[model samples]
Target: MMNLILHGYWRSSCSWRVRIVLNFKGLSAEYVPVHLVRGGGEQYYAEQRRINPMAQVPTLVVDGRSISQSVAIMEFLEETFPEPAMLPRDPYQRAKVRQLVEIVNSGIQPLQNLSVLKRLNSEGWDSDRVQSWAADWIRKGLLAYQDEMDSVGAQYSAGDSITLADAALVPQLVNARRFNVEFEGLSRLVEVETRLMNHPAFASTRPELQPDMEK
Candidate 1:
């Protein structure tokens, strides 16, 4: 049996990133769904919070130790299972891949996360205002993402070979589409996302296909 246990919600973009990386590495884990909306979030429960103090999804348990954060989990997997590597060997290329990953992870995803939007709602922001808030950040981040891609993008976000950046891009685009973010000038990034959507490894882990995804 696999020693890995992954706790996450199906619709969570961060969780989606870890799922993609696990598939890319040809690894399997016992998936434990932590419903983000049910009962005001299962992550906040004491049991789940013990595993991840942040009360966030996508916490990974490997060899009896808990690892939080999707990017960190992916990095651990990359280091432990290096075959069919997702990152390039060259130092410069590796840094470039991380740069792209951070653009989505820190820049785009954070600004559009459910918690942040809900906080806006709690602060008396209407749905349209919340959407505008997300759209503005997503648009600027994606435009910046496109510019970075133009310099080094290939079949994937980084190059012909898939990398950490691709793992981050697909899910960010999903959020973008959900918010109706415009893509008028992001053809390259869109093409990369399109290819990933068709890729078996990435496709299988989509939110709709997850075990916990509501029908």
Candidate 2:
């Protein structure tokens, strides 16, 4: 058995975070697809539910011990493996990297998550309206990120190398573009996301490459 089992949807941003970390660290694990759109999404399926009561995708099971939250999973992998480090070596710098990532993980992503969209749907919001909500939050959140980019520069989110922030940035950009949230101001992010798209680890993990993707 692969030591880790990733219960996630290919299109999920949170799931993508963990995927990037796994690839960056050269960790191979079982990919367990959970269709987040079918049958109201397999994340809600009873079996997956037992492992993750929150019914969220990107749940990482290590040695059959479950973990939730993308950042938590990222940190866990970093600690467990401790090779080809994903976080910066400097403690304060690493915290800064994490702070930038935090804005995305907690501040920005939740506003646009599937469950939030589903709730808006129950309130009679259409797809267009829901996407508008996503775009609104993403635009503002990324402007804040633009400031980070201005301070941090190109090679990294907080420093001159890939760190926690870069891992978080790529998938969020994908989501932003999907919702028509422009990346105009955050030029550095666009540059980085493009680079990451071609990167060996990032390229292989694109949502479109997943086994169950719809044509």
Winning candidate number (TM-score): 1
lDDT of 2 at 69: 89
| lDDT (tens digit, per residue) of candidate 2 on 168-208 | 98899889988998767777778777777777778888889
lDDT of 2 at 35: 88
Candidate 2 residue runs with Cα over 4 Å from true position: 150-152
Please write out the lDDT profile of model 1 over residues 3-42, one tens digit for every residue: 9999999999999999999998899999999999889989
Angstrom error of the Cα, residue 76, model 2: value is 0.2
* Candidate 1 error regions (>4 Å): 150-153
By summed lDDT, which 10 consecutive residues of candidate 2 come out lowest? 150-159
Model 2 CA RMSD to the hidden true structure, in angstroms: 1.7
Clashing pairs in 1: none
